[model samples]
Target: METLPIVPDAAVGAARHIDEYAAAGARYVTTGQQGAANTQRAYAGDWRRFTAWCREHGRESLPADVLTVAAFVTALAEAGKKVATIQRHCAALSKAHQLAGLPTPTDDRQLKTLLEGISREKGVRQKQAPAFTLAYFKRVLQGIDVERLDGVRDRALLLLGLAGAFRRDELASLDLAHLRFDEDGLVVELPRSKTNQKGEAEEKAVFFSPDRRSCPVRAVKDWLAVLEQHGRTSGPLFLSFHKGQRLSRRRLSTFSLNEIVQLRLGAPYTAHSLRASFVTIAKLNGADDAEVMNQTKHKTTDMIRRYTRLDNVRQHNAAQKLGL
Candidate 1:
């Protein structure tokens, strides 16, 4: 019945002492490398929520019973949790059970049926981030004072995010080493993204605009000069600033990036708007799905279509052209 006595290696190995046996058991239970930092954090948080709920309701969280999981998810739905959120909670529960070497109750018919009912009732369509107009974005740029350090940095940040159609995390993770410049434009080396996790390197090109005031290439060059002055030629591309606007060496968090977007671009826009708007604006201006996908790095046209894919249904609706 002992954990140590059951393990195949610890059973026959000469290191049969309790200490060595315990060490061997510990090694097997070490952290899983199944996902990115964000995913791990999400799972950890979800597990905590599950454990807390169990404590309140007199149910077991780990090696959880099917009825209890079904009940918990039902409660989540009653409490108005999104279908996506409920599904993630189930995934977290499964992950926890798998790591602990237990048969996950999520696979049981009761839980499965409960989730399907929840999905059918709630519908699985995710709410997309609101995208703003390119004209509005340009007006925002005109208002910024590029002469100031923060202005210079923020302008570069917004432009690169738009032109590259970068995901929020990708935009935040940019490093000096990821960039290469030539006469025509800047080439950004994307080693990893949510879609491309194999670490296969991909390149995105941002060309110079004849309009100097709104050029992504020029804005980035200016921000790099600021970085050079601060002796930060490598590491995270964006940084947090001190109280007096003195630059802090610490890299900006994704939350801070969203705050920046909300602060400068108005409250309706989140960091996702940069990418969504890029897709929307490009498609509206006659870029085909393939052309939009090229900038967005989307593996398929479906996601591109979704962003065609709308703040207002009227703006990008296919019906606009029906002369009827």
Candidate 2:
């Protein structure tokens, strides 16, 4: 065997340092623990699109110059992307540069001005998800046969989602271990959520209604009984059935929750509509902002106010008290 030249100690040290640096950079760029899975996926797609666009234009994507970022935002605006989407794209680029240990060009005055201009040129108003009012919820419940396994699961899912003011992903994340039952109702412990990404568990209470037909607590108990019969005592709280008949061990996805809402209501309502409806109904029923926030887990009063648009107008109407 031919003897190879021995590597110098200094050179070896430098090589090891470089390897460590590269590993740290990789962790910074690829770690998915910072945000929700959906957010991480969206950011990844946005970054890929930005890099592809840069390659096509013969420009650098990582550590992109201020002018390049400004032009990219302008192009996105021209492409009819919503202002919020463009902003998210910008944020994705910023995060990429940050991970690479480069200063973000998005913070440049020129890029900031360009983004503001884009927002002004293309309206900043986002299309709100339609609220599934209590009345509409009752009508949907009337159609479901609570005696069946699927019906029991869906009733429980829908009622808990609305009464607990749960996001679709939060509802889907629930497991048998997360629930606690009592005479009053059930308390669900959310280990992680969109807002509570740090895994600091938050508990939401769902009270039993006087009427069994619309009671979330009773609905959940009925579903639990069905689940127990299937010998599923400790998996997902809500599961998907095979062929709409036999229960499967699979957990329901957030998309399925949205589809469930739309199919039940026979309308375009999304899963978020349940959360919005909870806030809206609470406010309309004279629950204060803090009270609404408690159930919705909203951190800001501004968000609560926005969700209660009709209630706000009614409560503060100048003409109503003026007897005009």
Candidate 3:
């Protein structure tokens, strides 16, 4: 909440204007109806970077002049920043301008033209997928002792993430009533999911039908029992130690999955990788693509195919079947 530094007489007005603009922008961002925590964080980061850049360049706080904004962006791009990065910066600047009731800096036709040109020039692509394997997942689980509260929590998280193919946000949003254990197996109801589905989000369930009695359902049941023992129920499933507050998706970085994968597993993995792992393992165990898609709430069969098909593993298993 630090105030922007005051500049000398020349651009003093502009400096004050910029500071006001930034303050207004923060207020506007917080007022957004779109409640995605990640979106809020990204917007905050982008604007902070833009303001810091302005400070670095000895420019007044407010980017009131379109030309000054243009030159600043150009300098950013010239310094080897990626097109996506530049676009994010532009987006932040545009938002601040809108909040400040100033003219949109990124709205200039010339600026967009330059952005397109730079995008085509770079041809940048998303980074490669994080490396994750079953062995690494096991190691991460093994590292935590089952005696502690956190250990039980981590185990539940890991199992549900792999067994249910849950996104981190969905996992965080779950409540006690979302789960039910009958004699058959475990049933999970996802009331709020991030999909292109209609209405109040589609509800789905995953049944653990393993040959053995002690299956994934058993693991979930045990976790729940531990929670019951600790007198936890019918609230935010994952609570933070900070005054026992309900953990938000914004706290997802503290999940330890990525840290475990990178440090212990020595493999690059993310929350999404667990989703992929579920689809792949289910298919390997003879579950059809349709079934996998249903559990994952995937709308497209084509998208399911990409995750379920472990090409190299299939080929290797086929060879083994032929005794080759």
Candidate 4:
């Protein structure tokens, strides 16, 4: 006969703590639904790190007063931590306190004061991320030999990232069912991504081959055939052979497009460079902003335009036209 499973008392008690807290103000803030999963998880991690710090400092996380928070922030700053990192910890602490039905130490007044002080000290400014270029990508691709697993993985990864304009997280989440190929071309279906439309994570589709004559289309088609040869059907498309599981978002990030560039081409580039390259390449190929936006699934055409850097050929042609 089948038997019912038993629950550990300690585990049950810990869950009760969360349920009691949830009954308070936590439910009003975030339901841990929709796209807030990442936010919630981030806050939770921040809280854990804060609690660990608190224990070392001889204080309780929940019951700590404003003085403790001030001391923590001051100590963090003295330790040479960035203002953003300190703000993350503060945000986490505020959220955790609110959830626990305790008085928030970092209220609006505190947050405003901290922000103003940080701005004055650090000089508030936004730093633009480095963009990827085609030449850099080509150099990276050249480093990989198609005969090895790493090569296969890198080739498949670089193409998917560039062709599909997939985010690092989405890259790790790719499964076999996400791809479909026929005589016409290849279609990649992303059920959920960083930018979801209407609160339902967006599904992305890409037609690399407009008329069955694109190198990108042919490359991905070849990769799919190799995937089939492994006798694999419906699981993570980017598998981590070491773990024998799907690739993780964090792990994928460790070896970014920059590392890929450095490894293959002896240059540094970020993962989003592939995205920029995609936009620029698409535009040069005569695709309009709307067409590129649809492919990239960018919420705004303006943002898409930013990624579509001007190619040298276009610049030279425009210069010649000016002379004419």
lDDT of 1 by residue, 60-109 (tens): 55457888888889989999999999998888777666666778899998
Taken over the whole model, the C-alpha lDDT of each candidate is: 0.80, 0.79, 0.64, 0.62
- List model 2 lDDT by residue over 153-176, tens digit each: 888888999899998999998999
lDDT digits (tens) for residues 124-210 of candidate 3: 564534434566666676776767655566666666777788876677677788887777677777776657323364555655646
Q: Which stretches of candidate 2 lie over 4 Å from their true place?
A: 1-33, 309-324
At residue 57, what lDDT does model 3 achieve?
Answer: 64
Q: Candidate 1, after superposition: displacement of residue 28 in Å?
A: 10
Q: Which residue segments of model 1 deviate by more than 4 Å?
A: 1-33, 99-103, 120-125, 309-324
Question: Which digits, one per residue and each the tens of the lDDT, describe model 4 over residues 71-106?
Answer: 778777778777777787787777666555667888
Better of 1 and 2 by TM-score: 2
Question: What lDDT does candidate 3 reach at residue 221?
Answer: 67
Q: Order of all candidates by TM-score, from best down to worst? A: 2, 1, 4, 3
Leading candidate by TM-score: 2
TM-score of 3: 0.67
Per-residue error for 295 in candidate 3, Å, reads 4.2
lDDT of 3: 0.64
RMSD of 3: 6.6
